[model samples]
Target chain A: DQQVKQNSPSLSVQEGRISILNCDYTNSMFDYFLWYKKYPAEGPTFLISISSIKDKNEDGRFTVFLNKSAKHLSLHIVPSQPGDSAVYFCAASARVVTGANNLFFGTGTRLTVIP
Target chain B: EAGVTQFPSHSVIEKGQTVTLRCDPISGHDNLYWYRRVMGKEIKFLLHFVKESKQDESGMPNNRFLAERTGGTYSTLKVQPAELEDSGVYFCASSPGTSGAGEQYFGPGTRLTVT
Candidate 1:
């Protein structure tokens, strides 16, 4: 069973525009959400995260928004650059429910920025 | 300051062959995790190790797979008689603290191909 889902397999945006990636979850036990960006040959890198208690979290040009009721979350990148083009994965952890802290990840979405 | 390191970035073996993958976590990180992503599927959790003990192995596929972490440092995952379905990218991640909601850093994945 896939607890987390990213319906969009790919997204394309022009450079300097806004790029938004969306993700959804079926498990209500998930209290923490994270976004990971991966290059072609590299592992997924930690990008941003948000806790269930907060609705939005922003760092530099990246921002993440979480909606507890909708069981949805999104990653927004402003002024998208060519370097930001890569695969983005959405992962969730149920810290309070399971102390093991294993993450459940979605099938990542590949993003391309048109220069 | 080095991130997690994985050995044998790519491997190809017959179905009945045995293969081992290694991962070295960041210094002082007590939480280590293994995850795999088969083609066209989401990244799935394999196991977790805290120090030299096995914290969780519920995600392990079968008895053919074994994981060990000795001296609370590096870890090794071995697959005997690896199956064709085992072809995928394996990722290793580590976090400094016990609560690993958003702090886990990952290494470049190991791609395994069993024909």
Candidate 2:
């Protein structure tokens, strides 16, 4: 079963506009969430993250909002640029009693920002 | 400092062959992880190592896949008698410590094709 899901397979936005990507999780035990951006043939790069304790986290042009009650999260990039076009993945991790951490990832959303 | 480094960027071999993928984590990072993505699928975690011991390996698919980390620096994943279904991109990531809040640095990934 896919615990994390990115419903949109692709998205397109104009440069300087806001790009929003959504993700959902079925498991309520997840306590930490992260977003990674990946280019073709390269590994995913960490972009931003939000903890379950907080409703939102912002860094530069990227902002992530979490709604625990809905088991959902969204990433927003304001003034999107062409360099922002890439595959974005959402991942979650639940606190383990044994002190080890592992992440569950979503099937990435491809975002294209037109120049 | 350099990010994670992976060797043998691409490999193609016949079925039933043995292949080994290597990863060198950051100089002082203590956490290591392995992940893989098959065609049109989300990236999935395979294992995690803390220092020299494997902290979690629940994501390992089968006995044919073996992972090792010597001296807690670099890691090697060996797939023996690889099956056609094993064709995928394997990624390696590392973090500083046990903090679930830490960011994970990823390698370029190794693409393996089994014919």
C-alpha lDDT (0 to 100) for residue B7 of candidate 2: 86
- Write one digit per residue (lDDT tens) for candidate 1, span B42-109: 99999999898899999999999999999999999999989999999999999887554555899999
User: What CAPRI class is candidate 2?
Assistant: medium
Stretches off by above 4 angstroms in model 2 are: A96-98, B98-100
lDDT of 2 by residue, A2-115 (tens): 999999999999999999999999998888889999999899999999988999999999999999999999999998999999999999888543355678899999999999
Q: Which pairs clash (backbone N, Cα, C closer than 3 Å) in model 1?
A: none
**Segments of candidate 1 deviating more than 4 angstroms:** B98-101
Best by DockQ: 1
TM-score of 1: 0.98
TM-score of each: 0.98, 0.97
